[model samples]
Target: MNELATKHAALASRFQALAEAVQDWDAPTPVAEWKARDIVGHLTTWLPEMAAGYGIDLPKVTGDDPVQVWREHSANVQALLEDDAVTNRVVQTSAGDQTIAQVLDNFYLADIFMHQWDLAKASGQSVGWNPEVATSIVEGMTPMRDMLAESGQFGTPVVLDESHSPEERLAALIGRDPAWTAG
Candidate 1:
């Protein structure tokens, strides 16, 4: 697999691990109004739509089991990423038209990575994510912070100390409070 695909797969793996570790799907994540199950739901729901733009048909996952749904959908996304043809295809996005590979690299991959942290924080699990990836995401999102905040998809940005890690900074950039807990 290419670098983008590999990174997405790694993020997916981390998400799966967090899903497995969770004892309570009802636990609230740092993302306001989203629970542990909702984190998985968001991924499973959007991935197939994103794949559709590349002419890929992913199987529909049913049932109340969020982990199983995420597993099924994420596996389909991984399979699509493994195909060079699918990755190279151009697709229309809300931002504009972009290659599937670009979308994966800039959007889906980042979403999954952040959501991994959300699930972990919600479930009281620890994740050792790649700092390089977090730093890169922070850099990429810095310029888009206002637009994203205006979209209502994200909450207001939380202030954090400069001494915080890149992952925490990235979380703040996207309007997530890194220190948030279910309590």
Candidate 2:
């Protein structure tokens, strides 16, 4: 497995685990109006649709079972990471045409990493976070805060104390209430 594959496995394992542990698919997440299942749905839906433009035929999620939805998606993404022929294919982006692997590293994997907390919180579980990655995410995104908000991908920033961990700060930056818990 490559670096992207390894990272995806590590991050996606947490996501899949949370999906399995979910006591309520309908449990609300910090992202208002989203249920635990929506986290899985979002991850599963977007990437396949996005990758289709690059000619990589990944599996589209078919069922509402969050665990199964995540499992299928994760497996296919991992396969893509390991497939040199597919990963090397170029796709156009703001950064110019880059390989599928690069795009995955920059976007899909990061998204999965960030959403781990959302799914975990909704499922009443805890997820491990890498402060380094969290810091990088915050730093990289802070400059694009306005564009991100305008795109409606993130919400108004949630304030946190200086003592908050990088992961908590990341959650807040991405529009999740760091202190939010499942009801």
Q: How close is candidate 1 to the true structure, as a TM-score?
A: 0.89
Write down the worst ten-residue block by lDDT for model 1: 153-162
RMSD in Å for all candidates: 1.9, 1.6
Taken over the whole model, the C-alpha lDDT of each candidate is 0.79, 0.83
Mind giving the per-residue lDDT tens digits that candidate 1 earns over 37-121?
A: 9888887777677566567787656669887887888788888788898788878878798888898777678788877888888
Best-performing candidate as measured by lDDT: 2
- Pick out the ten consecutive residues of candidate 2 with the lowest summed lDDT: 153-162
Candidate 1 — which pairs collide?
none
| Error of model 1, residue 18, in angstroms | 0.8
Candidate 1 at 37: error in angstroms?
Answer: 0.4
Error of 1 at 114 (Å): 0.6
Candidate 1 structure lDDT: 0.79
